[model samples]
Target: MKKVTWKIQYDSTPLIHRHCKKCGKKTRFKSSDQFRINAQRQYLDIWLIYKCTKCNTTWNATIFSRISPQALTSEQLNQFQENDQALAKNYAFDFDLLRKNGAEYELPAFSIVGDDIGTGESAEVKLISEYILPIKVSTLLRKKLHLSQKSFRELVENGRIKDASGQNLLKSKLNGETTIIFLP
Candidate 1:
């Protein structure tokens, strides 16, 4: 079978959802791409900063709390202190960390990077993601293939499109990597 690969490319960091005391309601917060560090004698506390999109209020997402400065190497600590963009991006995309901080997050904008499948082509397509997002498999396929709900449903029902591992294509959430097969 012919093989194709698609990579998920996020355009922005996730927007955090939580109550903004200043706004008096839940609001989306965008990452400020900055880190705040506090030194308390022998311990250090670190956080990634976020701002309310609607009100510009600030919220700090805890990265490390009351941890010893020695816990991280000098290079790591320097990166945090300098507000490294890549390091900030890594923490900003951490869904589990966001949930642990009592905040919900919306997935950022993304584009699928790959060539489109030809008509009636039989192929194995691998979908890859750098981050474990909550996007659904069906949504990705339908969006990338420009298929309507009815057309996508028909293809799935008729077995013209299916998960390589037998996952329910309509209900499976994309996590890391997934393979789908197209049959002529």
Candidate 2:
């Protein structure tokens, strides 16, 4: 985690206007800091926090909300339960698929993976997640660890590669499996 510091002006809630004493200018604020409520704070985030663009003023702000961290309305709780149930079912199905399939998987292209999937390109990447060496990183290990890719797969399937780092990475990849993709 990094340190973060914020410099802001103390202004009224729903900060609307600011008066520049020097210029005798009053202009409407373009946007509200409330929009940044979703941001995560770092340890010393000095400049990352909001600052006034017009007068370079700093402001403190506040908002009111009744919901506690654990306070989920019945409707929200039900929706969350339903979502969790659906996720569990889907995860079970995928787990079974992965169990039968071995490492290497395919998923739609989006975000970090947007460059990888969702096209006429075939989705059949290699399944390396469940196998000892994570499929996505297997090729790299093949060179660095001086391990044969074929032999590595055979070793992993046979319960051989038992190092702590290897095991953890394999586990994480299986949990957050990336779609197997072909470079060519």
Candidate 3:
């Protein structure tokens, strides 16, 4: 069987959703790509800053709260103090941290990077993502293959497309990596 691999490439960081006191409603917040550090004697606190897209209000997402400065290496501490872009990006994409802060997030725009399979070709396809995302498998497949809902549904129902484990692909969400098989 032919093999193909697809990688999901995100275009930007996700926007966070939470109540904005200034806006008096829930609003989307975009990351400012900056970090704020506070040192209190022996402890240090770190936060990633975000701004309300609609009102420009600021919110700080906690990274480390009242932790010892010695807990992190000098390089790590310096990265946080200097607002490293990569470090900031890692924190910005952390959905668990966002959920813990009572906030929701929208997924960033993404493109599937892979070669296309021709009609009636048997193939094993692997889908991979760098981050754990809550994207629907059906949506990704349809977008990459340029298939309509009806066409995609028909293919699934007729056993042309299926997950490697035979899970219902239509109802499955992609977390990190998934394998699918296309029957000729």
> Which candidate has the top score in TM-score?
1
Q: After superposition, how far is residue 103 of candidate 3 from its true place, in Å?
A: 1.3
* Sequence-dependent TM-score of model 3: 0.86
Candidate 2, run of 10 with poorest lDDT: 42-51
Writing each residue's lDDT as its tens digit, candidate 2 over 78-170 gives 443344433222332243333342312333121121122332333333222222222344443343346676776765565443233445323
lDDT of 2 at 58: 42
The collision pairs in model 1 are none
Q: Which residue ranges in model 2 land beyond 4 Å of their true spot?
A: 1-70, 79-172, 181-184
Model 1 TM-score? 0.89
Ranking 2 against 3 by lDDT, winner: 3
Q: Per lDDT, what order, best first?
A: 1, 3, 2
lDDT by residue for model 3 (100-181), tens: 8777999899999999999899999999987777778999999999999899999999999999977799999888899999
Q: Which stretches of candidate 1 lie over 4 Å from their true place?
A: none
- RMSD (CA, Å), candidate 2 to true, equals 20.6
RMSD (Å) of each candidate, 1 decimal? 1.9, 20.6, 2.1
Q: What's the C-alpha lDDT at position 180 in model 3?
A: 92
